[model samples]
Target: MKLKLTLVLTIVSLSLFAQTKYSNEFMNIGVDAAALGMSNAVSSTTSDVNAGYWNPSGLINVEDNQLALMHSSYFANIANYDYAAFAMPIDDRSTIGISLIRFAVDDILDTTQLIDDQGNVNYDRISLFSTADYGFTFSYARKLPVQGLNYGINAKVIRRVIGDFANSWGFGFDAGIQFQTENNWKFGIMARDITTTFNSWSYDEESFARIQNAIEGQNQELPESSEITIPKLQIGVSKSYLFHYDYSFKTALDLNVRFEQNNDIISTSFASINPALGFEFGYVDMIFLRTGVGNFQNELQIDNSESLSFQPSFGVGFKYKGIHVDYAFTDIGDQSVALYSNVFSLKLDFSAFR
Candidate 1:
């Protein structure tokens, strides 16, 4: 009976928690609807404040100060995700940006374990709490001495809180470069968490100790420690093909790879390459339709089964005057679990105001 109870609790923990080898997993989720809509293939073609998150060097393409906001519902209303960013040009060759992202779940049932003198279980003691994550970024980009080349960097701070039980703070930095050709082709590379971010965690020791003791006896080690996040690199290319009367098609592709210690997902110093492809069709750069597919990996094993494997995304956007509205839906595989998300975004271009 004891063995069976342990197995059940383990299964419940795996199902309720997200499993990741790195810290601050929430930050790994894409921020803007426009980017996610393109399956995160905009590393090279990002042209607005969202560039701060994708590729800061792309901020050079913004003609004026821009503000971008996005909101998404994930996993059938299990959580709320939001993002906001602002970008401003300092001169013809320099730009600055600021961004904030938050992900949270509220009013979770916190249950208490109770037993009477006869070891009878009690189920009436349940409370509620919240879990949240926040990220703040400041960025700067400058056109290099060579025309058509740009460089940028970001400083980020992250915070995570869990229902008064534990909290963590982390810091990281990212760098990127972009090169554009006369023929409207663009190439970009970004290195995220280059210094390898570190998260220092603190917990309500007494409470957690008691819980741990009850769950795994007094000999088991409790959860406590600082974690180091690994770095990731992404490379991308984009091009626009023009047809008749300002009609055009924009296409982009990106490859992302992570560098970390030997682990289940990453067995070598460098392993696992994910590819993304996206296309946008537009008339006069106003009305647009987009589709993208990505998250190609061997681990999940692409199939028509109920497993949550690779995700395909679709999006649409419209540009009018100085405002842009965008929407994207991601078909997260595993129909059995019904996991999917919808994202909406709005952008305001200040160039018209100027």
Candidate 2:
């Protein structure tokens, strides 16, 4: 039974265009409009509540309690992603935050192949179902005794559901550190899924039995549980320059690496290690413009002849009093299909209102 299920999954995975090794890939999708706009190169440059997702240690830069909300249409409207976060300073030296991210697809056809007693196709039974993925994150950061350094950690719970068919539960943890130089240079390193996050899937046993009975001579049982791991390490650096008293520019770069094991073989490919670049220009801390490029997967491209694949992002932001609004346009590139994503975010500073 296990072998049968494994064979089916291997075939399906081969049929898919994406060649990702990890499950719950949505977790890596940048959350806030500002970060996504910057192509997720904010690991070292983030200073808002959104920092909880990018680099939690950056939360040390948040001076006031903040609430952030974001929504985006992904994959040309095929799916939707939403994010929310709240960060509050426990003291001048410590900060705590919580964040939620959800990705969902609606109205998917659930089909079953019905067969007659004589092994002839009776018909196709179809119904509607939906699929969703969710992650809840809790974060904490504190300034290190070493003056210019801060350390942070995140505990996350993951859940994935496919209508009434199957469900998965996962737990993961992340750790990060940030250093700020007196000259305004910021460096960050984050270990994502440091404990090797695992998802244990449980299928509908009754439904499986029914399907098996429906097909003559098919008596395979469903596997009780299957597990997959997610893990990665990322490092970044950023610098902000003040061209004038009221104008400044910030540039950031990030390098991501992951280690994976297949059949007792461990490997790391250059194509698997991604690099990101981002730039942001601000005027009097009120108006902002940003652009970024990253997510290179040339090595992973099934078609070696295909051009390198990368996404470019651009965004604008406005800030007034304690309210901030941001908009970002992300190009998903033409990888078998032309896809694009749009993100919008709002942020509130409670201290400013008070």
| Per-residue lDDT of model 1, residues 225-303, tens digit only | 5777788888999999989878999899998787653322224665657778999989898988898887754343357
| Candidate 1 positional error at 305, Å | 13
Q: What's the distance in Å from true for residue 293, model 1?
A: 0.9
What ranges in model 2 sit over 4 Å off?
Answer: 1-20, 113-126, 209-224, 260-271, 299-306, 333-337
Worst 10 residues of 1 by lDDT: 10-19
Of the candidates shown, which would achieve the greatest TM-score relative to the real structure? 1
lDDT per residue (tens digit) for residues 231-347 in model 2: 788889999999868998999999877775321112354324678899999999999999998876543446545345677889999999899999998876523456777789999
What TM-score against the true fold does each predicted structure earn? 0.86, 0.84
Off by over 4 Å in 1: 1-20, 113-125, 213-220, 260-269, 300-309, 332-337
In order, how many clashes per candidate? 0, 0
